[model samples]
Target chain A: MSEPAGMIHWEAQDSIGILTLDAPRGNFLSDPEFIAPEQLKDLLDQDGAKALVICGAGKHFSGGARLDDLFKLAANPVHLAERMNKGKSLLDFIENLDIPVIAVINGICFGGGLEIALACHIRICSEKALFAFPECNHSLMPGMGGTIRLPGKISWASSLETILGGDMLNAQEALNMKIVDEVLPQEAGMEKALLLAKKMTKDRPRKVIRYILQALRNYKSMPLAEAMKEETRMFCELAYEEMERRKNENLL
Target chain B: MKTSFKTLSVTYDDGLVHLEINQPPSNRMNSLFFNELSSLVDELCKKDGISAIVISGKGRHFSSGADLDDLLQKAVHPEKELSSSGTFSFFERNHFSFLYFEELNIPVISAIRGVCLGSAMELALFSHFRFCSEDAVMGLPESTFNLIPGIGGTSHLIKLAGLAKGLELVLHGEMFSAADALQYGIVDKILPRKEVVPFALEFAKKISVNYYKEKKTLYLNSAA
Candidate 1:
C-alpha cells in the first residue's frame, strides 16, 4: 500500500502482519512520524492475523528519538509528558498482544527503536545490529519503558551500566544478555523471523495460541496463588476438550 | 539424616544435604516421587544446619523424565488423584517445592548423569548450578506429547537461556548433549560420569565456605 512521506507502512501476508517503520529522516522516531498506538492496535485486530513481524524500512532500525523534536518538547513540559505517555501506551499494546510479535532488527536499534524491539515477544537481529540506550548521553532517559524492560532481559548491573553509560552493545553482546533472541546475517534476518512466525502460527488454533500467551503473561504479572489457580483451570479446560475430541473420534 | 525414602535417599552430612533419585535404570518421575520431593524440600528449607545441597540420581540415568504412563492414568481422572482445592490441578502443590528450591539462600547443585529429560531437567534448572556428565542427554520433550511444561520450565529456561533458545528447545523438542548444553549456557560444567557427583560435592563445599564468609562479613559490617 502507498503511504504519505515519513508514515509507517504495514501490510498483511497470509496470517502474518508486517509493520515497517519508514521515515524520511533516517527512520528516527519523532512525534509526528511515529506509528500511533491506535494504528498498531487496529493492525493487530485485523481478521485472521495470527502474528506480526516489525522491521525498519532502510539501513537503520532507528537512530532513536529526534533531538530536535525533543528540544521542542522540552520547551513544553506538558506536551512532552503527553507524548511520552502515548509512546508508552503504544509499546504496552505491542507487548500485550495475544499473537506473537517478532522484531527483525538490522543496523541501528538504539533508544526508542530498541524500546520497540524490546516490547516485542521475540527479537531477531542481524550480526551487525547495534543497540544502545544513548538517552543518558543527551541528559535524558528512555521514556517508553526501556528502563523497566531492560532489567528483566539482562542483569540489573548490565542494564544500569548500558543505560547510564550510554554505550552501544553489539549483536553478540545483546544475545549474551538475553536481550535479542537470535543474531543472523543481515540478509537472513527477516527471512528467519518470517519462518519463525510461520512455524509458531501454522496449524495452531487461535484459542490455544491465545491461551498460551495469556497464561504466560498471567504467570508473570499476577500473584503466584492467583496465577496457579488460573493455570489449573486452563489445564483442566484444555484436558476436557482433548478428552471430548478423543471420545468423538472413537465413535467415528 | 533420613536414610530411607521410597523413591529417593537422603543423607545429611556436615552441612551438605545429599539427595539422590534412587529409582533404577531409568528413574521415571511419578506422582509419588514428586510428593516425596515436595515433602523433602519443605523439611530441608526449615533446617538452619544445612549449608548446601547436591542432588543426583542412582543407577544409569538421572531421570527419564515424567512417568508418562502414570501421568496419563492420573490425568484421565485428575479429580481423584491430582486434585487440589476443588478438583483437578497439578499446579497447586509441587510448584511451591520448585520455587523453594530456586529461592534457597545457600547454593544448590544438580549432579546430572545419563539422561535428564522433561521435568527432571526442569528440576535441574531450579538449581543455582548444574554439573552434568559428558555423555548426559538433556531436553524438554513435553511438546512431543502435545503438552507444555506445566511447572516453571518455560519461564525458567527463558530466564536462563535466551527467548529464542527456549522457544527452539520447547517447540522442536530436540535433545542436546552436555557439550551442547554447556555451549548454550544451560549447564555450568561437564565432567566424567564417575566424577559428576564428586565434582558437585567439591563445588558445593567451596560455595558453602564462600557463603559463610560473606555472611560473616555482612554481620561484621552491620555490627560496626
Candidate 2:
C-alpha cells in the first residue's frame, strides 16, 4: 500500500499497514468534516495487510467527537439519531478488523481519540502524552462503546471511576493502569511500534488470533457457562483451521 | 401523591427546596430514595416561587452508593417497586436534573463532602457545577456492582475530566483527592468542610443573580 494525497495518509511496510490520521490532526474522527469511517474501513479491509499502525499527523492525536458537529446533531435530534447509528457501525468495523491494529499515541489522547485506539489490539504511546476521556463533563456518554470495552481491558472499577470522574492521566499512569501496552519517547513511538508489529507478524497464526478476538468480543455480556461454551467451540474451530492450514502448506 | 420517604429528606430553605439525604455518615442509595428523588424533582419542577434548588447531605459523607442495605431490602420486598409517573426514570433524572439547574429557572449546586460514590458521583456530574470539601474522597464504584454508570456518570464525567482520565476513573472506581479533583476540573474549589456551606450559599446566590437576568429576558421575549 501507498500514501494517499489529502484526507489521511496510508502506507505499508513488511505487510504492516500504517494509517496517519493527519486530517483530523490527531486520531481521525468519524465525521463528515474529516476522514469518514467508511473511508477508514475501506482502507483497513483492503487486501495484503497483516498488521497496522495508527498515529496522528499533527501535534495531537484527536480530541474525540467534533463538538461543533455534535452541537449540530444535538440541535437536530433526528439527524443526531441517524448519525449515531453510523458511528456504532464504524466502531464495529474497527473492533472486528481481521488484522491486529496498534495505536501510536503521539500527543493528547482524548474523547473519541482514546476510543478509536481502544478498538485496536495493541497500543504504543509516547511517554510524554496526556490521555483523557472527558465525555461525562459534556453531559454526554461515550456513544461509540467506550463504556463497555474499556472496563474489560482495565478493571471494572477503574472504568467506572474514569467515566464518572472525568480525569486525564499521563502516559506513565496509563501504562500503570494497563490502558496502553508500551510507552516510548514521542519521536520514537512509531518506529518502535512498527518494529514490534513486524515481530508480531512473524510465524503468527492469523486464524488463532482472529478466533480469540471474536471469542473475547462474543463473551463480553454472557453468563459464565455461555462464555465457556463459546470458548470450547472456538478452541475446536481453531484446531480445525490449523489442520487445514498445515495440509495446505504440505500440498504447496 | 404521598411519598414514602425512607431514603432522602426534602426540606425548604430561603425560598429554595433543599433535598438532603439523612442516612448519615454515608447516604447510600436505596430504591425508595431514588423513587422519592425522582418524584420530588418532578413535583418541584412545577410548583411556584421555588427559585433555587440545593442538593446536600446530612453528617459527613454525601452518599456512598446503592445501599447494600437497600438492595437486600429489595430482595426481600421485591413487590414494593415504585411506579414512577410523570418522572424521568432513574437515568433520566440524573441527566435532566442538571439541565433543571438551568431549565427550572434555578441554579443547582451539589455541596459534596467526604465520600461521594457511584450515583452520588452522578449528582456531582449533573449539578452544572460542584462544590467539594478538601476532606472529600469521591469516585464512581458502580463497576464493582457489575454495572456501568447508568445515571449519566459516563456522559458527565467524560465532559468534566476529558476522555483518558474519564476512562481511568470508570475503569478503576479509584478515589480522588480534593487536589486531584481541582486538577481534573472535577470540583470548582477545595475548601475546608467548615467553609463548604457558606461558600455554596454565596456561590449559589451569585449565580442566582445571573439566572434572574436571563429569566427576565426570556419572559419579555416570549410575552412580546
Candidate 3:
C-alpha cells in the first residue's frame, strides 16, 4: 500500500520503506512543515521496515525550498519558527533511526533538499547530481541542520566554503570532498541503493542491526571510554543470546 | 639541548622540529621507542620557538608498527609497570603519549613512506596532516593477530573515515594503497617518495605563521 503525506509518498517494498518526493519537474518544497514528524514516526513504527530509501519521483531530486513561500512565511515570525522547528525535528528523527536510511539522489539537490539528504545514514547519487547550498545567494543560511551536519560529514573548511560561497558542485567534486559516499551512472542510483540496502540488512536480525547502529551512533555522542563500555555490554548481550540459541539447537 | 636518542633522531631547522624514527629497515616500535617518544614529546612541550613539527622515518619505510614479539611478551607476562602516578596502566600511558601529539598547539605533519601499519598508522592518524608517498602501504593489522588497535586507532579511523568503512577496514585487517588511503580521508596528499618529506617540510614552513588564523585548505592548495 502507498500513502501520501503532503509532498512525500510513503510505500514499502520487500520490507524496505521508500519515501519519494512526489512533486513533478523541480520538486520544489512548498512548505517547511510538509510532513509532520509524528506522522512519519508512526508510519515507520507500523511498517516493520528493515531499511529506508529516500528519493525523488521524477528527474530532479529537488530544486529546494521555494523562496517565494519562504518569504511569505517570514512575514509571520511565529508561524515561520514553528514550521522550521517541525522540519528540523523531522530530519532529526530520520538521522536517529536505528534502521539505516539511504538517500538515492539524482539530478539537482540544493538547499533544503540537500539538508534532507544529509540526514540519511548513507548517500548514493547519480553522476549528473549537482549540489549546493544556495541559501547564501538568497541572503539566508540553511535553517535546518545543514550548518551542523555538513561539517560533520565533510571537512569544516570545505563545508564553510560550500555554504558561504553558494557554488554548485558536481558529483565528482562532492565525492572528492567526502560529501557523498558513491556516485553511479545517471539511472543506476536507485538500483545501487537498493542493492546496498539489502547488502547491509538482508538476513540480519532487527535487534542485531539496532544494536550495531546504536553503537555506531554512540561513538559520535559519548566519550571514547563510555562508548567502549557500551560496546562491551552490547557484545556480551549478543554473545549470551548466541550461546542460548546454540544450546537450544543442540538439545533439539 | 640533547642531540641524540636511541630510537629517534631530532633535528631543528629554523622554527621547524624534524623528528625522525631512527631504527631503520622497517623501524618497528618497541618499548624503547615508546619511552623515547614520551620523552621527546615532553621535551618538545617544554621547548620554545617550535613553530611546527614534522615526523618521518629514517630509511625506506616509516615503520612496521609495534613489535609483535615485544607486545605479546608484555601481554602474556602482564607486567605491573604502571605510570608514575601508579594508577594508569602501560596501555593507557602509551595512549596518552600518542594523544599528546594531537593536543599540541603547533601543526604536526607526518611524511609517510613505504609501509605504515598498526600503531604507526594510529600515530599518523593523530597528526594534523599526513602526506604519503605513492608506494605507501597503510593499515591497522592488529585484528589479524587476534587483537585490536590498542592506542586510539579504531576511534581515530572512524573519525577520519566514516563508521561503516572504518569498521570494515579494522575487521578485515587489510593493507590499502596510498590512493585508497587518500580516498578514505586518512592522508591529505600523496606525492613522490622523494618529494614527500620536502613537501611536508615546505608545507610546515608555509603554514606555521598563520596556522590557526587562516584556513588550512588555502595552504594545502597553495604551491609548496
The candidate scoring highest on TM-score is 1
lDDT of 2 by residue, B156-193 (tens): 67556744455446544567888888887787767789
Off by over 4 Å in 3: A1-52, A62-83, A96-101, A108-111, A130-143, A146-182, A194-252, B1-36, B47-52, B58-60, B64-92, B105-107, B140-175, B182-191, B194-223
Which structure is stronger by TM-score: 1 or 2? 1
lDDT of 2: 0.65
| TM-scores for every candidate against the unseen true structure | 0.82, 0.50, 0.63
lDDT of 1 by residue, A101-210 (tens): 89999999989999999989889999999999999998988878999999988899999999999999999999888788789998798889888887766666666566
Residue pairs in candidate 3 whose N, alpha carbon or C atoms collide under 3 angstroms: none
List, in the given order, the native-contact fraction of each candidate: 0.12, 0.00, 0.00
lDDT for each residue of candidate 1 in B1-224, tens digit (9 for 90 to 100)? 54357988887889998888878888888988888987887677667778888989988788988776565444544444443532254545666777777777787889999999988998898887788999999998765555656667666676666666766665556799999898878887788899999878877776676564225335323322
Predicted model with the maximum lDDT: 3
Candidate 3 matches the true fold with a TM-score of: 0.63
lDDT of 3 by residue, A1-252 (tens): 112265888988777888888775678887765577677777777888888899988888888789988999899999889788878888988888887888999999999999999998888899999999999998999998999999988889999999999999999999888788889999899988777676656656676667656766777889976665555445434434443454566821
RMSD of each: 5.2, 16.6, 7.4
Clashing pairs in 1: none
User: Which DockQ value does candidate 3 get?
Assistant: 0.06
List model 2 lDDT by residue over A88-139, tens digit each. Answer: 6656676676556778887888877787778776788987888888988888
- Best-first order by DockQ: 1, 3, 2
**Top-DockQ candidate index:** 1
Tens digit of lDDT per residue, candidate 3, span B31-141?
Answer: 889888888877877888999999999999999998865644443212332334221244555677777888777889999999999889988988889999999999987
